[model samples]
Target: MSEALRRDYRVCEEIGRGRFGVVHRCYSPESGESFAVKSIDKRLISEDSVDRQCLYNEVKVMNLLTPNPNVVQIFNVYEDDIQLHIVLELCNASDLFERVTNRVFSESEAVAVMLPLMEAIAHCHSHGVAHRDIKPDNILFDEWNRLKLADFGSAECFREGELMSGVVGTPYYVAPEVVAGSEYCEKVDVWSAGVILYIMLAGIPPFYGDSATEIFEAVLRANLRFPPRVFHSVSPVAKDLLRKMLCKDVSRRFTAEQVLRHPWMTSGGETGSVAVLT
Candidate 1:
């Protein structure tokens, strides 16, 4: 543990660790409240400026998030000569991947995830932020199974109506415009969300292969199977929603707002409110 750790909070145990550093489960002694502290060892620099820029961008985006139920609250940020710390709400529940392993989600439950997810994405879009990486790992569930979008490490901010040009994000969830070497906008994030929603309903991704190259080819071709065996009870309406969401052209795909009102999503939904301004 760093000597700079807040003495106000008792560092409990290591809850998570990865390339960045370690995340400690911490508890506030005064209020008996628990939170996760994300520690990034900045001293161990990556190979290029891109990695440093990406880390700094993540910090900037997290700092800009507004108070919203579906968004993870970044409580504090502090750093030392060797590490940068991010304190966040600690929800020790399972992720979408874990849920999918046990039970297939009903259309109602899928809608529950979709409504908040769409609203959160819209909030990001409205604030000129693009969460370039959207996937099951980045979505967290609280005690009530409510959804929260986490990890803005791959986010980019664009000027009014301007699109960014660069290949970013995970291969399986990347948008066509991004894959095709063309400039793309917020719709790219929508594409990734569609893939996530599709996985939630169907219990697997639309495109898959043994290697990254094959998966990229499938996404580029929009190759997929209808009525996948795992999705036996899913309705045609849900399938149609997925098709529209995964459209190759970002322009033709559903906007975050349009996705909120879609039949399969709104027919069984609860409205949510979220803001993304600093």
Candidate 2:
């Protein structure tokens, strides 16, 4: 085998698969560091323009992230003529989807997770990185329940001291400015983080519909709702904070730091909210 093809990866088992490629648990014999190997099929890209550049961007961006406590770390990159390989640190704990699919996050559970979630997002913003995609799948918990933000494929950099423009992010979580074709910036990331917080507390996303248009419409025109069941034990201050974070207007949403200061964020009670990213 070629030296590159002869890597000492254990190739444990398949953990994820998407249109672009497959992800597997792998480990290095020399370092003994666990890694998630994402192999993208070159066939997935027809033209070598923006798509290919994006593939490369994922590599470059991961390299640039500060070694913050919450951000996923990229360890190596490899490619054959037919496939691009990205190997990243494996966050072995369950993700938000797993938590939700299984149902329930006790108040203490929510608080413990949110603290790290906010810290990570704050760190990303401080580093000039925007996690354009925020949803349950992206959030993960290690055995210690430590939160780590995963997946930077959709992350983008804003111009220095400049906000962002155009639409980017999951449909339900996209901020109003992004959805309305107005200029947006890092605050959009805060909006997604809020959505994540809501999910952790409440167990479901605030916006949902029969179709994408309907869901987007709900996000754009509807008020985010919280139920009494969710609020039964949650404090008024926490609900008030949720009201602020999930606000429809991008300008109106609470910043990650601001949300971090919310009483509930510290107290750790939640009823419902948006999904986590993978």
Candidate 3:
């Protein structure tokens, strides 16, 4: 298998490392196209059984959503006794976290970046997959500056009317129900996306604390505020959508599909040709 990979492509420098594997830059000698190869050591998987399951689950979800412009594209999978290799579309421009860290995005810019993401998450939900984690780091941009949602390690499929109770996700971006260990639906991803949008526009998270405990408490209370310093210039429609997305009541929160059609999203006139799912 190693010989096959070496023969077909030139595997290059490491680009990313996660709990499941290390991602490396690889180029196909024939096509001259670049791709990412995630190498997960079988030994590491043996040590933590769940890690292997997560790796396979990520692959399953990525494969299920293939050809979607807003989701990372997985090309092939190579496996042997040593490790499992999954080839993915390389986003040379990097993830949204880096972009957000470098500069504050205006409301228009935030909407442009988020519209596709909203569609991607909606598509995932429509297919019964829930991306338990939806933060800036999981959102990536390709060479064309097109946004793609990545990292499906925490994703799970739910039947109709199913509820998820796992306590997962980053503290600051987690939904109130998730923080309280209550069963949650795919809308939890909407809450997290709302947090990302808040950070993108406001230049900081809506919820914060000195420690995880305090952050969790704040999340449970779900007291959201858009202070004037950040939101002063933001349009009222944008704030209204933000409020809907961040609503503490799951029933009131906007689903990803609904968010894409919100007046603010449609009225911005900044949304590109994103393939929004119904």
Candidate 4:
């Protein structure tokens, strides 16, 4: 543990763990406030390694995108000889991955989730940042049931009209262009969000295989279909939006702003608040 961190906050038990660190539930005794602190061990990462750079990049990106309701807010950073501690806003509720595993979401509920997510993506894109690794595991819910997009480890910043080249992101949520190793823009996030929507409504990913390579093959194919057994009840409007988002041709792929403007998202419905799944 970092002595600087211990001096500032009362770090508690482990709440989560990741590749290079463990997350602890911490408390600010001064204000009686709670927060999550991700403590990364410096020994595990080399000084000139990409992993170390990503750590710095994640902090920089999160700081750039702070104050956005849909994004996780960072509080403080404490580094000692052994570890790096990042103090962040705590989300007591489970993540979207856990929630989806329990039950399928109705169209309205999916809309509620998608709206805030798109808004967050739009916010990121407008600020020249691409959250290259958007997946269910990173979609968190706060105490108020508001969705908060977390984890910027794979995020990158780009200039206007510039393209990013990287195979970053979960297999199921990666865009076809990314799979093809082509240069991509912020629209890649929209594609990933579409995959999340498909999973939310159908309880399965649109593309799947027995292995990662096969899944990548299916993604490269970009053959999207809604099986009657699962999608019969899903609205055509919803599917239409999905098609636009999951389109293989990046030229036709819907941007985050376009997705928010779609009929299904704009039609009569309560989107300002997300559904509190039981």
Candidate 5:
């Protein structure tokens, strides 16, 4: 723990460790409150301009989206010679992946996840910020089990008519346009959301391969398949929403706002509408 961080908050335990750095469960002795403090090594980021820019962008975007309930909140940022400490709302509860990984999510269950997820993304898009990375691992559940979006390290801000070109995103959740090296917009995130929904309902990714290279190739082709055994029990409305979200054509992909009003997303108690996956 950095001495600067320790002065204000008592570091209780190490909660997470990743390629970037460490996340500790901390408490502010002054306020008697607990929070998660993510400390990233400055040298690790300063080595690459893109990495440094991403770190700064993450802080900017998260701060902008702070008012949204479904988005994680960043309370403060502290820096030292060797590290940058970001104080964030700690979700001691399990993440989406850990919560439902091996289980099948019924239409209602899928809605429970997608509705809030889309609402958060819609909020981001309306504010001209694109959460370039969206996946199960980035979604966290609090003590009440309400889902919240986290990890904005890859997020970018853009104007209404602007286009961004970058091959940034996890291989399994990447949009086709991104893999094709085409200038894309916020819709790329919708593609990733579709992949997440697919994983939730089918218990697997729609496009999968043995390696990252193969997965990237599959995403480029955009040949999404819905095996009957896996998708047989999923609702038609749910599948329809997924098809629109995962559309190979960026123009055809459903916007986050549209996704919020989608039938599968709105029809709360009607979980019996099954999709015919041929």
Candidate 6:
């Protein structure tokens, strides 16, 4: 742990661990509040390596997007010769991945989760930041049960009309355009959010395979289907929204803002009079 971090906060037991570091539950004596400190071992990473760049990028992106309720807030950063410690809001509840694996969510429950998620994504897009990696693992819940989007290791900044390239997301949630290695926009995050929605309702990813290559192939095919067995109870409005989100043609895909306005979302999972887009 960084001495500066230790001087400022009471770092406690490990709460979680990730690729480059471990997250510890910490307390700020000044505010009488608890937080998380993600400590990264600098010795394990090279100065000029992609891993080091990603660490810096995550901090930059999070700094740009903080103060939004749905997005995890970064409070402080501490660095020393051996480690880098980031102080962040502590979210005690399990992440979306653990929640989804435990049980499928009803449309109403799904709406509750997706609403904040879309809000976060919309906020990111409006600020010209693309959260290239938006998956269940990165969606956390605070003690108040508010959904908080975490992790920005793959985030990038972009202009409104310009396109970005380089595939940079997980297999199951990657957008079709990304799988095709074609230039894409912030809408790629929307596609990943759509996959999360599908998994929340159906308890399985819409696209699946035994390997990364196979998964990429499936994503490129973009053959979206709702197995009657799992989706029989799902609402048509929700299904329509999914189709719009997971559309292979990026032109037809729903933007984060558009998704927020969709009837399925606006109505709190209840059916509304708005005509479904084809």
Error of 1 at 32 (Å): 1.9
lDDT of 1: 0.80
Question: What is candidate 6's lDDT per residue for 1-278, written digit by digit as tens?
Answer: 66778789998899999777899999989988999999999989999998899899989999999999999999999998899998999999999998999689988899999999999999999999999999999999999899999999889999989999998999999998998889999999999999999999999999999999999999999999999999878888899999999998888999999999998999998662333322
Best by TM-score: 6
Residue 240, candidate 4: Cα error in Å is 0.7
> What's the true lDDT of residue 217 in model 2?
80
Using lDDT, rank the candidates from best to worst.
6, 4, 5, 3, 1, 2
Q: Would you give me the overall lDDT of model 4?
A: 0.91
Q: Which stretches of candidate 1 lie over 4 Å from their true place?
A: 1-4, 46-48, 228-232, 269-278
Off by over 4 Å in 5: 1-4, 269-278
Instruction: Give TM per candidate.
Output: 0.90, 0.87, 0.93, 0.95, 0.94, 0.96
Model 5, 114-167: lDDT tens digits are: 888999999999999999889888999878888899999899899998999988
Q: What is the lDDT of residue 215 in candidate 3?
A: 93
User: How many backbone clashes does every candidate have?
Assistant: 0, 21, 0, 0, 1, 0
True-vs-predicted CA distance for residue 77, candidate 2, Å? 0.7
Stretches off by above 4 angstroms in model 3 are 269-278
Q: lDDT of model 2 at residue 132?
A: 81
Q: Compared to the true structure, candidate 6 yields what TM-score?
A: 0.96
- Candidate 4, residue 68: the lDDT equals 97
The lDDT, on a scale of 0 to 1, for candidate 6 is: 0.92
Worst 10 residues of 2 by lDDT: 269-278
- How many backbone overlaps does candidate 5 show? 1
Residue pairs whose backbone atoms clash in candidate 3: none
Please write out the lDDT profile of model 3 over residues 176-253, one tens digit for every residue: 998888898999999999999888888888999999999999888888898988777766677788899999988889
